[model samples]
Target: MYGKAAICLTFVILFLVSCSIYIGTVDLRSYFFPLLQSPPVLRSLCATGRPLRVYMYDLPRKFHVGMLDRRSSEEAAPVTMENLPPWPSSSGIKRQHSVEYWLMASLLYDGQDEDEREAVRVSDPEKADAFFVPFFSSLSFNTHGHNMTDPETEIDRQLQVELLEFLQQSKDYQRSGGRDHVIPMTHPNAFRFLREQLNASILIVVDFGRYPKTMSSLRKDVVAPYVHVVDSFTDDDPLDPYESRATLLFFRGNTVRKDEGKIRVKLAKILAGSDDVHYEKSVATPKNIKMSTEGMRSSKFCLHPAGDTPSSCRLFDAIVSHCVPVIVSDKIELPYEDEIDYTEFSIFFSMKEALEPGYLVNHLRQFPKSRWVQMWKLLKNISRHYEFQYPPKKEDAVNMLWRQIKHKLPGVQLAVHRSRRLKVPDWWRRKR
Candidate 1:
């Protein structure tokens, strides 16, 4: 009896230490502890103040592996360091449309960094905080699904069907119902088939325009900035943006688009003949980008009206050029909102306000020289946060994305716990 009593006391002491450790960081006693019967059979905690462990799914060749082969053959050539935009000195080589590339690089290459050590890939799914489905969904869709009129010819649908089957069979996916899974859907048309089916999963999309509130929002999804294509202004370019910028407002892109994008056509008509605003239709070719770069650098405010989606790469380009972005989209979402405030750097105008004749330009002109200069300086400083670099940097787009995913852990934990008791419908229980 004395031996058993001593053992009980030891166990009590260890439990108290563990609870104290947990309380130091998060007061999860009222939040996560009560819901858990054991030490979370579904989620294995990271032992306090550690970067969350993420498991990258080893999918079949056709789904993600084959994508590298396909794009390497024809889509576009790899962007070398010579062509890369001016990034921070710490930044290494990076691709132009690098969302797919940087994600794969980070997952495959174990860099010499403490943060990278935190996100070590585990083969065991049971020990992971999140499951990363590294499907080059954007690359796959852009190659096979984009501009296809026939739904039957779409190859992404077949891949999605297979992916759904594979995920449903996994015990880990069954436990959380994909709430802990992270899938990149940066392209507007990515995951064309059964998007609603995978809505429970965390989607890394460029915007919420394609997804409804039931499946995606600021709550469950991440809004990633598009991979910028334009070259940035170097330190040798200009000392003063105001002195160098001759044009008041400049825009060069398609004028016609669906939904909120139609405002572009109206604004083009309104701003036409205004000497300060240079509005012209431009294509996304190599030569046109050179022309666009010149225009952006020479302009004070770069016009960023909505395209097919709520957000576009133009805003990022404007930032790299040290040009203040005059945004007109009301529903557009940006990345890293928790850390960086958009109002401090960029200007936002409602569709109603932008459509009004001369109101948009007049409002921009009303800002004093000091205010415009301050906003331009802020824009240049925040440009690094929007960039994706190889091996990942401290606060680059890749690191910020991981940080955002970390912020969702509490909410994901609650959802997983609630789901353990909540009865899901029969329709949501099917494998196919």
Candidate 2:
């Protein structure tokens, strides 16, 4: 039986399909960004040339922080939140690619030494260019979105309702209807319950997998990184990556998944026990985390197949481990694509090309040793963009995310101005 959320989503899909006729008639891009034809020039508001002034809403702890609550020692199987060697623990979730942790960290970062930057967080909403709603939507979903059989058990519905009601009642939201607001929905299912209500706003997401293709566009959203979970193959580690690696290719993760992830089972059948190729199932338990990291570090290439969603943390892990990533997902949308050229350091294979007998392995083998080394070195250099840091460093993931958000300011501004001029009826606004 489908839950209410799923039923609502189905209705949304139908509504979007019917509305496509009207949407096609208008140039939607121009409606959102009037300055699309020309380059968007950034005018500095303060002495520092910060283009985007962000005002972060002080949401109650229950929305973001409360869900990460650890069990007390008196309770069974208590878990303490601690900063581990590779992945931080403040935002909960064991994986470094935790969108909840990363998104919150980015906005919360006060900056290194407080000087100048492209995106600056302002305490006053009156002085802000963009408003940030740091609700940790991804974490909320993960913690409460289970039990599809019961709608009451899902915390997302209530949280989304509260979030929308709060925002809608705000003076800022009333002015522009959240067009200039930024909300991180990095996980595919994050805020899925109220996606339509939030669609016009600036969204920070991983990919467009959850939305219908026609409705989801890169023009309105920022693609952000997965918090990488693997420990970096640093100089302190005794093993030399080039010499210690004996496996040509390795991948260990959920072999059984739905949607595009069906490819994993097929690939497993094709590559299992092949010479120098190691493919196995792995549970991401604490013990397995160590094993997975070691496996990737000891392999020349790591396979990145599409999961239920097009993107996965495995690709980021491979980058930090200095393993050349073999991407098999045709629909995968990467983060920071404009800033970083993935083709330089990673190998790509269309699903069709990868499935052609012996094609994938042979193509990877054709790369010369020197070329492979070049890719590995480049991965090491660019891997910093995928790293989330506290007090965000100059070139780290937090800074990179803000840069992406900065790119969206022109469009957001135009959208807000357009919406103000249109002045849709209150009934229509509530309906939407």
Q: What is the C-alpha RMSD of each candidate to the true structure, in Å?
A: 10.9, 13.1
Give each model a TM-score: 0.79, 0.79
Alpha carbon lDDT at 68, candidate 2: 59
- Candidate 1 lDDT over 64-103, as tens digits, reads 5455554333333333323322323322112233475566
lDDT of 2 at 268: 86
Per-residue lDDT over 1-432 for candidate 2, one digit per residue giving the tens place of the 0 to 100 score = 569889999999878866885767545544664453221222112223554678878776667655556331222322112321123354333354355555555555553454434466677989998888868787677777455656644677888899999999999987887888888887777787788888878888877878786655788788886777777776523335565678888999998887988999899877865788898988677677779889998888999999888888888889888899999987888887755668888899999887777888887767687788777777777777777765457667776777777777787788777767767779898999
Q: Residue pairs in steric clash, candidate 1?
A: none
Candidate 2 regions off by >4 Å? 1-48, 70-97, 115-118, 150-152, 236-243, 424-432
What's the true lDDT of residue 253 in model 1?
Answer: 81
